[model samples]
Structures are given as structure tokens and as C-alpha cells.
Target chain A: MTAAATGVRATARIVARDDGRGGTSLPVLEGDGPLALRRTRGSGDEAHVMLVGAMSGPLGGDHFAVRAGVEAGARLRVGSAAATIALPGQAKGEARYDVRLTVADGAELRWLPEQLISAGGSDLRVTTHADLAATARLVLREEQVLGRVGEEPGRLVSRLVVRIEGRTLLDQELDCGPGAPGGWDGPAVLGGHRAVGQAVVVRPEFEDRPVSARVLGEGAAVVPLAGPAALVTAVAPDALRLRRVLDEALKSLG
Target chain B: MSRAALLVLADGRFPAGGHAHSGGAEAAVKAGRVTGAASLEDFCRGRLHTAGRVSAALAAAAVLGVDPVRLDAAADARTPSPALRATARKLGRQLMRAARATWPSSELDALAREFPKGAHQPVVLGLAARAAGLGALDAAYCAAYESVSGPASATVRLLSLDPFDATGVLARLAPELDLVADQAVEAARECVDAGVDALPAASAPLLEISAEAHAAWAVRLFAS
Candidate 1:
């Protein structure tokens, strides 16, 4: 599918299938620009893709959204091509992107996207909601860099809500302002950290595990990954290594 | 006259075995998901709406003698993390012992006999709250507070914060206490009327991952 025209309302739909051989594949449906799909060789048939688009010229403020819906008993591996830059808005200095996903019973969705950079005075919000049937599985990753590179830092107000069976599972509101108190400033919270990210993996397979603890560090301490069906989170400096570690860990899960 | 009793239930040192678990804070801290008091507050707030509220509501119903078996099942469905379920059972056991000592009743004894493995903490806690002459709202508030404060107070020791500062944090969180407690009471009433099986299931995936990771850790300060 060709990429959508610049400044045009655009929507991308990608459907993935479980090959029944413990592998997954994505087949692009309507899209524009460059959306490449392939399977990782000798890696238990993991689906891989790269989505690249142009933002230059009259296409400013053009919105992009992706909807991925998985069928029952299917497994999917989803990711992005490059870091998404939320360009300065025409009026508010920002752009918007939305991602919606659904996983069916006995199916799994592994969604990992690159860090999003929102320029100073930019306004952006990404909301991801997933509906899971009984026994469905999901692994979602989202990373945000609040400001531009080596410039006056910008502000990013983000809200993330996830629900299953019409019930809210995770509802997060992050407002990062300059010198916000009791926010990212204290010793036990975000502290002085600028880059923030989260990865979540859910399946009934690990239902015997407990839900409370002090510290969960095993395998690698500095990288920030968790679980038997481990998900990873890391700052920009460690993101690449964390990604590699995550890929290796996920590969081992099969 | 029972204001002292309410205070005891609300106190951070109630010894309901809360200090033994971090309510997913420890795992989040280890993962760098939460670092200090401020972030901890945010995490607590998020939970107050999700798992914390669900547990509080279920507990309120249980205290009202709504039906232990159904409440347990509903709680099991709502709690996706296996680690959390075990912790609930453990906390339930401790709460039962304390509840029996404070106010023993045949209903409590029967519920204990029916589920020797240990009832879900919320279910037992609700019963205990009712036995103590607390209303559904109070039961919900106490449950929600314990749910968050258990971890907050635990983090104080785990992160080595001053007790005074820890209590201050709790005091600051007091306003939210009423908000979530009200939500829980309303939700519990709805669930009880609808039947436990009809209760909504709300599970936080990241929190679940943290709990699973914590369970697998070789060295852990808390049992959760």
C-alpha cells in the first residue's frame, strides 16, 4: 500500500496472523509512503516492519493513526521504523498520533514503538486502548522524550489508559512541568529523570505469581526489564541496549 | 466512642502485615518505574482508581456479609497478578486473626471454615469492618488506605525515609482517601446487587509484570 498524501487525513491498518507454527506475520492493508514487512530469519518467525513517512512541505498538521486488530488464536509482533517526531504545531506547535489495538482470546500482541520527541511548546497525546478476550495476552511498550535534543526543554502532557472487558486496567496521567513538586522531583519518583517509558505484559500463564514486592531485579539491573514474560523500560542512553536485551529475552520466551 | 477503634484501623502501624509488601512499589522502584515520594504518590493515585478501588469495594461487600465465595472469585478475576493473589491470601490470614481477636462472630468463623486456604483480604476485611461496627463507606476507606499505605509505609523502610516524612505523605494523601473510599462504596454496592460474578475485572499489566518480576527475584526484602 502506498503512503497517504501529505496533509491528508490518513489511517493505516495492519493485520497479523499466527502461522500455527509458533510464528506471526503482518500484512499491510491501506497505507502510503514506505511500510516494509518481513520476518526475522531464524528467530522463530517474528514479524518485523519499518514505517517511514515524509513531514516536509504542505503536509504539516497531517494526522497519522494506526489500528491493529488481532484475530482469536493469533499472535502478532509490531514495531516502528524510526523515532516519531511530533513537529511544532501550526498554532499550538504540535501534532497528534493515535494507536488502537485489540487482541482476541488465546492471542498475543507485542507492540513496541520508538521514542516520541515533542518539541518545545508542543501539544501531543497518544491514547492506546486494548480489548482482550478471556485468556488473551498483550505486551505493549511506549516511550516519550519530553523535549527536543540539546535545546530549551519542552513540555509533554501524556495520558495512557488501558482497559480489558470494559474495565480499566491502567490509567496514567503524566504532566511534566518545570520544577513540578512531588512529581518527578523527589528522590523516590522520577527525580531528575527526563526520559520515561513503560512496558506491560499480561497473560494468565503467570497467574500463580504474586503482585506486591520491594525490588524486582534479575538478569540485568541497569536496563530496567521485568517478568518471566519480561517487558523492558529504559532511558534514552540505555534504550538501544534495552531493546536488544528485550529482543533476546522475548526470543527466549518461545 | 469507637473513634479510637477507627484510628487503630487507620493507623499505619496497625500491623495487618501490610509492611511486609510494597503493593508493587518495590518492583516499580527496582524497575525505575517509580523513584521517590512524589512518583510514589502518583503510582498510588493511579492504583486508587484501578486495583485499589476494586479491592476496596469487594472488601466492603465482604464486610456486609455479601458472600465470601463469590467475593473471593470476583477478587481472583480482578487481580491478574498471581503474586498479588498470594499476598492477598497471606494478608487475609493475618487480618482474620486480628479480626477474630477484636470481634469474633459465627459468620467470620463460618467463612474461615469454608475457605481454609484463606479468603481474599478484601472479603475478610469487609467482614471485619462490619464486625467492628464500621459502615460500608468506612470499610471501603480503610481498605483503600491500607492498600496504598501498606506500600507507602513499606517503602519508607525499604528506601530508608524518615518516619515523620512517611506519615506526612500519608497525611497529604488523606484527601484522596475520601475520594477513593466513596468510589469503592458505590462500586461495591453495584457489584453486590449485580452479584459477584458480574463484578468488573480491572487489571494493570505493568503492575502485573512488576509483581511477576519481584516474585522471581532471588533476594527480596518483602514477601510480595
Candidate 2:
């Protein structure tokens, strides 16, 4: 019920509305408790909000809650300057973040948060819940690296739940770890690859896309959801390779 | 409650159409994640705790008289893969037919009518357990066993792995199976007052991800 009960409490909120000149502008820009948002230059109907971490990063025993909204006839693009590096806190526990997003009628939002780098002794949980109107459109991309550039993978978990017009569309929980938190092997999860990315596109009355379950290149594959969602989970030997795979997925998503 | 009924439900040859799907093992085998018996054991252990654990909880909750529709939504929330979701509903239909014939119950008939297309496999498994006069623990056992048994049987055919080794893998997992089943029933009991959110949502994304890849395989032996 309270942020203190969970851990160190940190929160951010962003509210954007239409500007009448065929674009959108941020009217409620607030952050930096732990996450800071900056407006970036953009063209056409796109407005970018780049996230900046205020602290060294999320340490163990840290809690973050981010809330964003796109009003009617507005377009909002969400991204970050760099990937997040999760480290253990003084208490040596898990860091958790809860994200709540809303897309009003005729609004569009693109969420492409950078990959998360999980360090050893790190336990991280990120959950995002989206409420969309029937005429709203959303593109959500979440990527994660199990361990640091060179380290043993820690326990990382993320859960996403989306509701369109009060109807549940996507509800999934993913855990990445060395063991215990649903340990990974060569076969069932990432196939020995330490990186995975999941993307979803929700648009009402959208036609079926040709992307099904096909490997993008060496270690990347696109796992298409039944409806408008395209679930892509790609794994590479290293983080660099994983970034390439994520880039390819972005193009494929295009 | 009838242990015989639990066995009848847990039996691999229960005619629930489980034989058609490899439970994502086919995908893992092709990816070389499950090369032999050892890796397969690891895979099964992860499943027994994650997806398998979640399924057992769902079944157990159903046996505890939780609303099937709400449980079905919770199942969707737990399952992130579209392919696996489809497989679950298909298996639910198959199990419902067997349940209607083997143990006639008005509840089963009504479930069949409501979810004519199908609900979810775990939800149906739980209802079937209730109809057969089984308890929550029995339902958990039935669902947990199927989670591993389906893959173990499929591996013997997919990689031509030694059948004895596979059975040995199951044997090694017997203790863990008991622990997970017990945990599932304990969680189910709380749902009686706390609602379906009390159910565990643990999942293996790779299993759901690989199920998609397995579904796209035109030459694969298993449907999922």
C-alpha cells in the first residue's frame, strides 16, 4: 500500500496532450525522484521523452514507480539515453519497479526502454500495466541482459499486463536467472544466450502480420503473439550480439 | 477423494490429446537446449517449479471451488505465449470430452457448454478433479506430473534419447514433484478468501517463446 513498505520509494509521472497544430506537447513533465525525463527534439507528430537515471542506478532494495499518459490525438515516444545497470544495494536484495501507462482514444505511444544490465547479486523485478482505449495504438519494446558485460547472471524478472478497452490483451511474466528463479538452460528459455527482448504492438482492427516464429539471424527469433502482438525473444552469445538482434527486431517491427 | 481418480487423470494415456504436443520440448531439442538426459532433467526441474508449479496451482484452485471463468483469466495472465495459450485451450477441450465420458458430472457438462471452444487445460483439469471427487492436492499432482511427463515422453521420440534415462530423470524429480504439488495446494487454499491473485504466476518465458517457434515448424512432429 505504501512505497516505504516495499523498499526505497521513487516515482515519476509524465502527461502529454495534443497541441492543436497537429502535434502533442508535454504539459505535465515531472521526474528525478529516481528517474528524470527530458524532452528531445523531434519532427512531425512524434515527441520523445528520454529517461535519465538520477542515482548510480537501482541498487538492491530500491523501488521505482513510473506513470505516463498520452491524451487524445497525441503521440508520445518513450526511450532512454542508455541501458540500466542494476547493482546490489547495501542490504543486498532485489530492486523492483512498477510502470503504469495509459493511452486515451486516438493516442499513440512507443515505449522502447533500453536493455537492462543485471549485475551479480542483483535481483530485479519490473512490471508494466497499460490501459488503452479502443482507438488507441501502442508499441512496447522491453529488452534485458541477464548479467553485466562479463559476469554471472543474477535474478531478473519482468511482468507485462495490457488491457485494451477493458479487455485483457497481454499478461506475461518472464524470469532470467542462473538458478532458482526459474533457472535457464540451453533449450527451453534463451538457448544459452544471456539476452532476451520482448515486443508487442496493440492496434484495434489490425490485420495479421506475416511475422511468426522465425529466427532473425544467428540467435534471434521472432515469436509472434496470436493477435496484434508480436512477441520477439532473441538471444546471442554476448551483449553486443544481443544489441544487434534487438536492432534487427526494431527494423522488423517497422 | 479417490486416488484412483487422480491416477486416471494423471495417466499419460488418459486420451486428453496430450500426446500431440511436446510441451515445448520439441523446440528446445531442436535448439540443442536438451541434448541428452542431464539437460532434459534441468529443463524439467525449471518447469516443475515455474510453469508446472503455476499449472498445479490453477488445478488445485479449481478443485477448491474457485470460479472457472476467473481462473481462466488468471491462466491467460500467467501464460504469455499465444501458441501455448492455444495449445492449452485445445488440450482443455480434449480433456473435457474424456471427463464427460469417464466421470459424468453436471458441472463438466456446463463447463463444456460455456467454453465450447475451450477454456484452459489447467482449469479443466481442476474441474475434472472435482468431478471425480478428488481434492486440491490430487489436482496439483495430476497437473504437475503432466507438465514433465509430456516432455519426457516427447523427448524419447524427438531425439531418440534412451527411454530408461528419461524415466530416470522423472525418478530424480519425484521429490521435487511432491514439494511443488504441496506448495500448489497450499497456495490454492489461500485463494478461497484472497481471490485468484493468491495463485502463483511463476513462468518460464523461454518455454512460451519456444512454443511459438515449435508451432511454426512445418516438419515438426509435435503441434506445439
Candidate 3:
């Protein structure tokens, strides 16, 4: 089911402000676009923001640029409302998603987007660039499902770059297409698996999260970077199983 | 420009220490991914396209006079696995020794002095290419070939599959490798004016995950 090639260019931004005299949490800012931000107040200074896709999932040629900022002394929890399905449209047979995040000192951002489902004949590129302060904190999770159950997988090229004080802490990329090159089908790669997930966490307390998590997890790889930077990546047969495993890994950090 | 210099720098037996690691093939083999020659070809092909392509582009970009500092960061971003990062650094250190000895370039000496611990392997390969008067395509070919060659040689020992069969797998992949190297050089050319972000970053999550798995193994024939 191909939709007409609609050049969907959408931008969403979130800036957090510390709520003084905080008994109940309140949103600082909200807006609408192809994707929107809905603040779900948490306790104290922390607020939860769920990203809602205003329209159907992005089709081929759709471009999305999402920016998020957490002001000093404020905390934000970001989530995606639902799964994003990628279909090849007329826009050169590809779609692109880019996210930029800034975490100020004494602030925190928990970014957990729901899984992205890519159908056969789909090509997508996602790049995440994050700049952090010495005293700031960030937890980012990205999950991808190749194709629907009993369906063929699509192509995805994803990159994540995180820097602290102008120094790169974690920089990585994953490119997978059902049968494209780069060894997704090889034993060294996905081993013919269907789903892959990754998470980047930078909290003061989880310094050894990478190596420690390896001892705790089944087949996942955790890598700790300079300072508080750490990441975990894994491949599984299905989305649910991968998510469950990653959720547990994320929890183990605390 | 110096084809002979390129050959000498890119040789598998350059004694730069590529032999110590299996390029993550050890993990794959243990996971039962490469059972025979057919599977081995598929594995190399995937790497040639993804990691291999990225490495080649990084090397090419370095040869084109792009700042090594940024390219080094770009390499880090492209590589996710901790174990793989360590292996690349080790290989880079070894290559640095050999490149300095063979080429005797002050730039290589400065790089060695800057990264006393070591730099990433592909970054060194690019600098080495520049010192050797080789083109980006040459560096890309060297990096691309090395990406698969390590695994192929390691599989021969792990599976004890026929050596002739393994060599034939590489032989058949020659054309695809040429194409990948060409594409890598093309991508690097795009980054001449822009930043290194234009380079290809095709990655393999399982290759990275399994490298971590392989590193923790109490006992393994080849270092990852």
C-alpha cells in the first residue's frame, strides 16, 4: 500500500523549565506538527513528554527534524505514542529522520521512542546528535523492527553521536536492510535475525554500565565510553523480546 | 600515484598486526553464523558493504587532506562495539609502527606522538595511504579488503573449512569489493567540502554485539 509521495517536512521542539514549589509536575512547553509534544507531569521537577505523531506514520520522502532541550535544573521524560511504520513512497524511495537534543547542566532527559516498523522496499536514515553539559544527564533508547511478522524486512541506516563539553563520548551507526550489504545476513552480524535495538545512557552513577550489563544480559553488548557515557546493543528474533530485554538492561542501570 | 607503494602498504603481510584479530569472525563462527564457504561469502559481503565501506571512506577522506581529528571522531561514531574499538586501536598502533618504519614521514611521527595509546585502524590506514602517495580508492580498497580478509582467514582456522574453498570465496567477491571500494571513494569525495558526516555509516549491530560476547569468552583462538 503505497501513499502518494507527499513531501512531509515537520519539526517538533521541547524546552523544559524547572517548576518552582513543585508538589505536582507541570509541562513547560507544547506544540503541534507531524509530531507533537504532550507533557505528562511527574513528581517534583521532572516532567514526562510523549511524542504523538499527528498524521499517519511518515511515508516515503517524508523528512522529520525533531529538536528537544532540557533547561538547567529541569528534568524531562520523552516517549513516542505509537510505532512508526516506514513505507517506500515516490520521494526517491526513502524517508529521513533527524533528532537533536541538548541537555543543560543540572538537567536530565529520558528519551525512549517506540519501535519503528519498516516494510519491505522501504529505505530510511536516522541520525541523532546530542550535546551535553558536564553536569547534565541523558538516557536515549532507539529500537527498530525489520518487517512485520511473516513479512520481509526493509533497509535502515541509523547514526548516533553524543558529545560532552565538545568532546565526543559515544558515536555509532547501524545500517541494516533485509538483504542489503553490511552483513545483516551473515553470522557475524544479525545471524539472519529480524530485529535490533540500542540504548545510550549517561548518568553519573552508571559508570560501569557497559561491562557490568554484559555479565547480566544474555546476548547483548554494552560499551561504556569516557566519563558517564555508556551504550547497549542487541539483536533478537522479534521486537517484543528485544524490548523486554532492553527494558531490563535499562532498569539494571539504576 | 605510487601503485607499488599502495600495494606494499595494503599487503596483508605488511606485519602491521592485522593477523592477531579475526575482525569479529570469531564471534560469528561461535554463534554458528559461518558454517561453510557459502556462509563465509555472505559474511564478508555484508562487512564489505557496511563496515568495510565506512573504513574505506574514512581512509580516503584522510588521504584527501581532511583533518584527522574529525575523521577519528567520525570513525568512533561509525564503530559501536567496545571490543571492536579496542581491536581497531591495537591494529592502528601496530600499523603506526610499520608505517613510520616504511614511509618515515614526519606527519606519521606527529600522529604517533599525538595518539601515544593509539588511533583507530582505518584512520591510520588513511594517513598511511597519504604517506604512500596513494589515492582514496587505494586506501578504500586496502581497508575494504582487510575488513573481509581477517574474517576469511580466521574462519579457515575456526571451521577448518577447506583453505581452497575460503580463497575461492574471496576470489568470487573480488568484483563486489571493487564496487564497494569505488563507492567509498565517491562518498569521501562528497565530504571534501562538507563535513565527515557525509561518509557512509552502514553498521552491523550483531557484529558489534557478538564482539562483546567474544571478548568475554574465557578462551578463544583468535582475538576479536
Candidate 4:
């Protein structure tokens, strides 16, 4: 084997608790390596957290993880300041980013990370998993841009798995860019689109009256899941249009 | 395993209710993406690899004695679109009728009873293949081939193009089909050890997106 950089391994954890004074408290806020977590102001009782990059290079061969937990009656929203770029590094191994989210009874979590851009000559595989209690609520959004401007995309594989109680809500994996299966850019797949986004909203109220399936606009559609959740998937020629489609779909979902 | 049974299971006219759905080709055709044989070939190839790959692995795993209930849940997890899920179950229900009449296996009957509305088509297909004395590879081949063949035939009817051209498209994709089927079987083997998470989850976003749109069409030639 050729000599190469071993890669960076980082883990960040955040836990939101229901404070007695009608607000949420972050009793556990931890960060390591390139994953920097900071607690910012949130509206009302919600606790907001922003992910700030401490350094570049989730490049090839990196291992990163983020775990967020919301206790009963707590509300937490997580977002990133900017898009995370996956770049090629000295090593040939694929980068790994795993996100684990948990919402307790009567808790709510909004995971709205910015888009992750896969740059040329990079390989990144991301898996996001969320487990919710029966009465929990979650809004999770994921957007991926295949490549930077004016270049072919590297290999990118992303999977999102969400479960409520003990039942699966939505589980899907999208593989794209170079070394992916053929026809990924074909009409039936991305249709020459370089950006793809999905948003999953879960609320207990949906159990009584589920959301109807509808197309938000061109390149986007929202459909209710078998569980008390609705999933909106959108693809566009670029990141801007993709975000727009998801925004409109979220509005309609609201 | 019976080689002839594989052929019978893979037959297009197997009365599985697949004829009503265009497999997303109707939307692609209306969008002017699949105008003729060349574009249809491209479209079929896309389905063959993404959706096709996933379906084949699920089918192959089902043939490997995986629990039908768990496999059905896995299939549900893989399919994000409700319309496509409904179509798959509808086709699965229809295929269940055809398979039980032909093979009369207890597994198929039990699964049918469990999912009275229907299980996913790929899961039913694997059970059907098992009832027909076929192997995992055979199930995978059938699933992968149908992924492309359905779109091709649908395009033929939607565009009213020559059937021979559609057949040719399938012929050209024969080698890739074999490769995908083999990959699916390999993944299925891993699932036997590592669980359903080992199965490939490749998805075609456009197909899932357009299937929702196609389902809302006021007047459409195909069901999906």
C-alpha cells in the first residue's frame, strides 16, 4: 500500500434539556477536531445551535460524527453557517460523516444543515439517522450539490434514515458523481441536474389527518410517508433552484 | 432451480398488472426527454442501474430466505414516493394472485395474507421466484430486466414507436443487466450476514419526483 495521510476523526455532541423557566437548556455541548458547535439564540423556547467549521478538509479519508439529543419538552434547531465542501486529500479512502439525532417524548428537533458540496476528485459518504419518540416532532433537511462550478463531480453517497417509535418512516440512499452507477445523470434519475434536496417533516398531528401527496413545482414533489411524516424531494440544475423548490415545498407543508 | 421457471417468471405477459404503469417513462416522454429509440435507450439504462439495481438486490435477498415482513419493510424504506409504493403494492397484489395460481406455495400465501393490500412488487417477485424453484440470481435478473423492459415497452406504446427498437434497447443492455444482476446477488449474500442494510439503496431522484407528478395527471396513458 502506498503511504498517505491517515485522516482526521472528530465527534461533536449536543443535548438539549427542558429548562424549568419555559426555555431549553444545553446541558451537554461538546466539540472535537474540525466540528465546532456553538449555542446561539433561538426563538421562544427553542434552543438553536450553529455548526462552525474549525478547519477545512473533511477531504478524503476523514471520519466525522455529530450527535444531537432533545429531552422531553425540549426544542432544538441545528444549522450550519456555510456549506461543507468535500475535497480530495492525500489519501484515497472515502470520507465518512455520520449524524445521529434523538428526540424524546414531546420533544422537537429541526435539523437544517446547509448544502454539502462535493468537489472534484473527492469522495464522501454521509449517513444521517434520526430516532423519535411516538410524540416527538422532527424537521430534517438535506441538500447535496454534485460538484463545484465547471467541473465533474467526485463520488458522493448519502443516506437518510428516520424512524418513529419502532417503525421506519423514510430510508433512502442517493449515489452520484464519478464511479457511481451509470445513467445517474439520465432523465429518469437526476435529469442532468447537479443538485438534489430532501426535507422530512414529522408531527403527531399528521397521524389523524395525513398530508396529501402533491407536486410542489417543477423538479419537486411532497408525499406523505407511511408514518406520521411527509417527505419532499427536489432536484434542480443548480443549488439555488433546488433550495427554492424545497423552500416552496416547506411553505406548502406548513 | 428451474431455468424454465425463470423465463416464465420474467415473461412480460405474466399478468402481474405491470402493463398499466409506464415506470416513469410517461413523464419522461411528455417532458421531451425520451423522444425516440436513442433517448429511450438512455432512459431505460438509467432505470436499469439505479432503481433496477435496488429492486434486484431486494428480490435476490427475498429469495435467500429473508423474512418477507422485514424485506417488505426494507422495500418500504427504499421507496420514498407514495405513488410508487402504491403502484408496487398493486402490482405485488396482482402478481401474488398469478403466482399462487401457478406455484401455490405456502410462503406466497402467507405473505399475501399478511399484506392483503399488497407487499412491494420486488418482494413478491422474490417469493414468486422461490415458489417457482428459482435461485437468487434468477430473481435478481428478473427484477433488473423488468426495470428496463417496463420503461421500454411503455415508451413504445406512449410514443407509438416500433416495438423492435424497444427490444433492441433491451438487447443492447443485456451485458449491463448481467453485471447488475450479479452485483445484486452479491449484495443479497451480504444481506444474509449483515442484514438488509447491506442491500444497495441506489435511488433515481427524477423517477421518484416525476412519479408523483404523473400520478396527479388528469389524463395519462400510464398509471405511473
Highest lDDT: which candidate? Answer: 4
Which pairs clash in the backbone of model 4? none
Q: Write the per-residue lDDT of candidate 4 for residues A61-126, one digit (tens) a residue.
A: 888899999999999999998999999997769998999999999999999999999999999999
- Candidate 3 is graded, for docking, as medium
lDDT of 4 by residue, B19-57 (tens): 888899999999888899988888888898888998999
Give model 1's DockQ, 2 decimals. Answer: 0.09
Kindly indicate the candidate among 1 and 4 with the higher TM-score: 4
Per-residue lDDT over A1-254 for candidate 1, one digit per residue giving the tens place of the 0 to 100 score: 22343333456777767777777656544464423333433245545544455443112345557778777777777766677765554432234466778887788777877777655655554556666666778877776665665543344545554556654454443445342222332222333444566565666664454223322233221111122223333333334544554454444344
Q: Which of the CAPRI classes, incorrect, acceptable, medium or high, describes model 2?
A: acceptable
The local lDDT score (0 to 100) that residue B117 gets in candidate 4 is: 99
Q: For candidate 4, state the interface root-mean-square deviation in angstroms to 1 decimal.
A: 1.1
**CA RMSD of all predictions:** 7.3, 2.9, 2.9, 2.2
Model 4, which residues run further than 4 Å from truth?
A1-4
* Pick by TM-score: 1 or 3, better one: 3
Q: Is candidate 2 or candidate 3 better by TM-score?
A: 3
Clashing pairs for predicted structure model 2, backbone only = A60-A89, A186-B33, A187-B33, A189-B206
lDDT of 4: 0.90
Residue A161, candidate 3: alpha-carbon lDDT: 82
- Sorting all predicted structures by TM-score, with the top scorer first, yields 4, 3, 2, 1
- Provide i-RMS per model in Å: 8.5, 3.0, 2.4, 1.1
Measured against the true structure, the TM-scores of the candidates, in listed sequence, are: 0.61, 0.91, 0.91, 0.96
Q: Candidate 2 on B152-196: residue-level lDDT in tens?
A: 999999989999999998999999899989999999999889987
Model 2 residue B58 CA deviation in Å: 2.1
